[model samples]
Target: MSTSTSTSTVSEEYVSTASRPSDLRITDVRVANLHGVPFRSSIIRIDTNQGLVGYGEVRDQASASYALVLKSRIVGENPCNLDKVFRKIKQFGHHGRQGGGVSGIEMALMDLAGKAYGVPAYALVGGKFRDTVRCYADTPSLLDPHEMGERLLERKRRGFTMLKMDVGISLLWDVPGALIAPAGSRDDVSTMHPFTGIQVTPKGVEHLASYVDTVRSIVGYDVALAADHFGHIAIDSCIRIGRALEPFTLAWIEDLIPWQYTDQWRQLTEAVAVPTCTGEDIYLTENFKPLLDAGAIRVVHPDPATSGGIAETKRLGDYAQEKGIAMALHLAASPIATMACVHLAAATENFLALEHHAADVPFWSDLVTGLPRPLIQDGYITVPDTPGLGFGEINEELFRQQLDPRDPVFFAETTHWDGEFSHDRLWS
Candidate 1:
């Protein structure tokens, strides 16, 4: 018998030996914890026997244990079978931060598959629609209206053409007679949006609109300015505020009321000239179907880390586009999650712009090494051609400098998160 085999006529025995479990078995799962603005962030790495690793992130403030527990179910399986792995794990996920675990795991799997096949993450989905992803920056609220105007001007100076800001009623807190509520209870938050009875006085309305007026005066009409964080006011107040700002021409007023109030969003959307947007905390596509079907809002904002990873978010965007709704991603995590959004935005045609929440952090872009230097420039991130989320390695030294001092651990041992706690099957 000859030991040598021809390249075209390779033996089945040789093929069997070269393929299967040995070449791509899962080896380990590790996590690095860092502080993303407003909360903490956990970055997970899925390492295989072949030395390739996939990276993902649990939504900021979500416990990394949500993803680590699934390690037992997938330790020895092929990381390349993303859909199979996702289906097996999707049952365990729910809405909000609960979805973070499953979505993060899905992101890691996509990263893995992208690397194994030598393609960009978006290529694994539906391929690229654009090479650069536009980004929007969030400006913090300032007590002084003039200072806020100056602050917004600085962002424009930095070349960001699109911006969002907090326009909550909290601004009118100190203004006597501006708001009327229960003696001590907060009127802005009652059983629901309509019942809140949180009306803005004629003066208060002017005060709130003045914030937008100042920003518009400085940044002018060239920028796409949006508003959010209205301090949980009623739909009526949201409409009142929205109506007052109609002249400013905002891109959208985000999350005017809770997303669950689909009818409220519809009413506000119909009543106001400004566009309405929501759904950053949503988890599944089906959950978003009703809102789109009702023509509830003009835009859908999904944070990939909280939504059902890439496929679900893309599905949401596709469905939104079908109904003429644009998708503007909501992201506030580290580079791990940012790249995931980049790939998703690349593959999605209706994507408007992804959010960049760490502009003030200074070291935010310094935490990762694989993507282009200055991850964002002039409000746009040029998509990287490299495989697996396009990041080379975690810049640990830089990351450590910004790690949350209260809980600093870089890929710490999580052996206890290794086992399943309960049977996850939902239906009998």
Candidate 2:
């Protein structure tokens, strides 16, 4: 794909050229499900006669229908006219996770275009600012203090100086009971259904504190400890939990309150000495401006897939930097998005750390081959200087092993509804 720009008083011309006489046709778009994972994602490949191909992933799980519908609109478009194609398709798709299809397709096209032009994806987004991207190890949920200590040590051994742990499971210590209790009731509130479940009980809080104490003792004060995945609890409950975990000197308490509660986040951030962070589920950079402007969070957490892919994520980080707020990326799922995050992190100056969920997956690092640099070393990831995402090929053997036999990841081609749904009037 080639890029060209021509300016005129009456009009402006910007066109991208495919290497061959024929345009780059989206030959195939496939969706694959990783075994034992929560959701299925769509991966699009745009192929050209020049033997150039581009790849992109749509963040859709349980919502594969949206991706299938998008394939129809993109199959015949020239992959080189990415912006034009993205705008055109986005007009028809504007609600829910369906936006992921358009966004994912855009990412793939950009990757392809960069390869076609012999440049890195970061180069396509202007240029790069750094080479090595800092990564943080996300510690899994642990029920026992010993288990938690072991996880922390493992992360240290992996060369990760920053670690995040689950501190909100105290509400689940009771079985056959609700996850969170009512505002002031000590009695079992399990009967309250989803409304009054318990997220942190007195006993559960003590257990969490003991666990944090254990982790602190093991990792010591040198490494950074962060906490997240606190089940939904009241603002007061979050403040209490934040204060309780203070001895660990956590880097931040993530998503303490739901992301939409800006004022509550402000209160929580102010109530405790620990820094507060959120924003993984938030949409575009525009959505993040409010939280950053209000100082509701000290650090901005954006998952590139959820926040409009690489370009938009970098824009969000640049905006956060302008506000003097640090940025930490939240990533989960396949290496497609993780590699994209690495490129974006490498280009942004305010980057703090990138999440590596597949760090434990033995073949996860090998899923993509021909990486410009080793995937990890001493807890740091070296960014690839190669064109596009710098991935040589997909490890079919590993992907096959991890494929969910029941679901079997494959793209389901189908047309979307052309008209508004009947339920649209109900909300109005």
Candidate 3:
């Protein structure tokens, strides 16, 4: 059953949390940087005059500048005016990491609106399908079968029921006759998938299959397992590898082919018994339509940080639900972004699981307050009824301690990005 509720029919005044007509306005847009071991990611804070604030994070490795640049256009607008506010800044967001800013801004706005209205973010979108969102452990791929098995088994021990691993030709470099270098390009994955000539030989396929077999032997058949980052090989190799691993019943072969090549995706889906998944690099629903329409892949992976935030992600899920396609979220961000995924996952009926890429970072759960201490338990995030995103605030001392030595901890007044430099008019 779908817990999704259409609150649009409910008047804003009726949902107000402050007991008044809900006249809160955006006051400040602040940015902060947090580290994931060596990698640095950005988070945003959208404050309102009513003392309610919303927090969000940009896509991993993207700049806080992406979110800060939009402050001028967003400040002073009513955070509750989502449709209008999103459209106003939607023009500023483009594909890939550039979309992070607009998406982050939208997330912050949802939190603000949810807080002012005293509701969870999911309630603002639709209701929810589950109180808890399932998480898949995104454990790093280890080349050594013994080590990989141990690593995956540790994830199982840690309580992640579902798991994904990095597997591909990159890990097979030492094996004999595994990959053929392209005609002109270096061994780097610079060449496109099909043209890369990075053929995965039969020996290569068996080696990779054996590795997954080792993982399956340790974790057993009950838990769902997925494979990702298999190098930039083409469709033929993808099918060969997928077919070889068919007996393992791998959950899905992710990004086996690049996301844009729909025909290839369709071919991979048709060729293999295992499922296929993609769409993290994709920006909005428009880009995903062709993939869905073609029935290209069995699963649609939309990273909330990259896929236009909470509402747009639900739109993706709703679209997938109609087409009978499952949706899995790609998350490699902070708990703030992960919680956004949790709220959206609760609301989306088609949701499968949300990726918990930061499980290895001990301080990962410590980054945010007010949410649960563990953030994830037994591979699931229990939804909180607390108003807004339910994350109280960023742990300033811990955040500063984890800051990228190259950047400052929080917003240092992005006045340079405060104003629009050029007119942005699409219509004549």
Candidate 4:
């Protein structure tokens, strides 16, 4: 019982009391709302009793309440038990931004589990298929096709091998005889594609194809070009536009119609030579089944922040792979979410590319530390093998500078949320 003998008996391999994984408990969950770090986004911090912390981001433009409401459900649970906590809280989630809360928390859990066990997040998801994840830069639509081509060329000049641009019916709204839609319905975003009775006239189809022609001519065939935001056009319009751009060999046409329209997706996929893609709003793996089962699309684009975070998106990618469909991530949030996507893309075999939506945001890489200076290199993110999401620290100073004015609090005490309760059970 002598102190000297007791000290000598301790093994070198013994874990320190401070790092005990089993004893780890969720102490609190807080939010930092940031605005125009490009766009509004909420970053979630899950604190533990052991002084360890993990970070995640709500989908871009999503409200912070999406995460705060779930704080009470996880206050005392183990962060490492990801699936258990996920199952307990997932019922509260739904498709689109509503899923941000459960998805962000899942990411935080993956971070904590990785840090606790001392492995990269990808390792926790069965390891990686690649070291570097190729990124595709998103170039917004410009009225002038040549100007848009020049913008895409700038992306190429920055070393991006893949690029995407907006090609939709909106561009044809003012053009005489370009589009055939109800007089006042063109601007109404609430209208679904099929109900709008929108048709792309031959003139509109030609105009849309001209933009792709201009871009493809400037960027050349070596670059993998993609298009998105088809503006809720009907199936016939989508097919017409798709066929018109087939000569350009687009990587894929994204969200051609709503993801819920699997039958329409199949029709669009079959009618057009260009590959059809959707599912950025989809929430879970099973939700992607109908599209996959019917061979509705050639590529499945899921934003990890919306598609159930780390493990679930990986599962979605695995399922897509089995059905011979490729996956490309959709992300427009902070570097925290970007790293999460990089980890998922690395682990998923059929991952085609991870969308880099903030390539133009100068301070995007500055928001996180312990990574390379330029977060993206030559249109690819080198997957970090470091523990968790691979960033050593959050650049708090930068976050403070970019805080959303409406909710200027940064990681403020969330005690009010701790008392919130809901009967979340779906079955007896």
Query: Which candidate number has the best TM-score?
Result: 4
Residue pairs of candidate 2 with colliding backbone atoms: 55-108, 171-199, 179-198, 180-197, 180-198, 180-199, 181-197, 181-198
**Runs with alpha carbons beyond 4 Å of true place in candidate 3:** 1-21, 183-187
- Ranking under TM-score, best-scoring first? 4, 3, 1, 2
Write down the RMSD of all candidates, one decimal each: 3.0, 6.6, 6.0, 1.8
Error of 2 at 124 (Å): 1.3
lDDT tens string, model 4, 230-253? 897788888888899999999999
Candidate 2, 1-428: lDDT as tens digits? 12333234224324444353235566555565565322455455555556677766666452544445556566667776666666655543332354566556667777877777777888877677888888888868777767787878898887888888887754354534324555554544333212444456565666667778887898888988888877656776677778888877888889866677678778888888888999877767777887888888988997776677777778899999999999999876566766777788888889899877656766656667886334778888787878788788776777666665765654333233222133222234
Best by lDDT: 4
Q: Report the lDDT tens digits of candidate 1 across residue range 211-286.
A: 7898789788988988888865677778888899999999999987888988888999999999899998888888
Q: Give the TM-scores of the predictions, in the order they appear.
A: 0.93, 0.82, 0.93, 0.97
Q: What are the runs in model 1 whose C-alpha is more than 4 Å off?
A: 1-4, 8-23, 36-38, 186-197
In TM-score terms, candidate 3 sits at 0.93
Every candidate's lDDT? 0.83, 0.70, 0.84, 0.90
**Residue 126 in candidate 3 has what lDDT?**
83
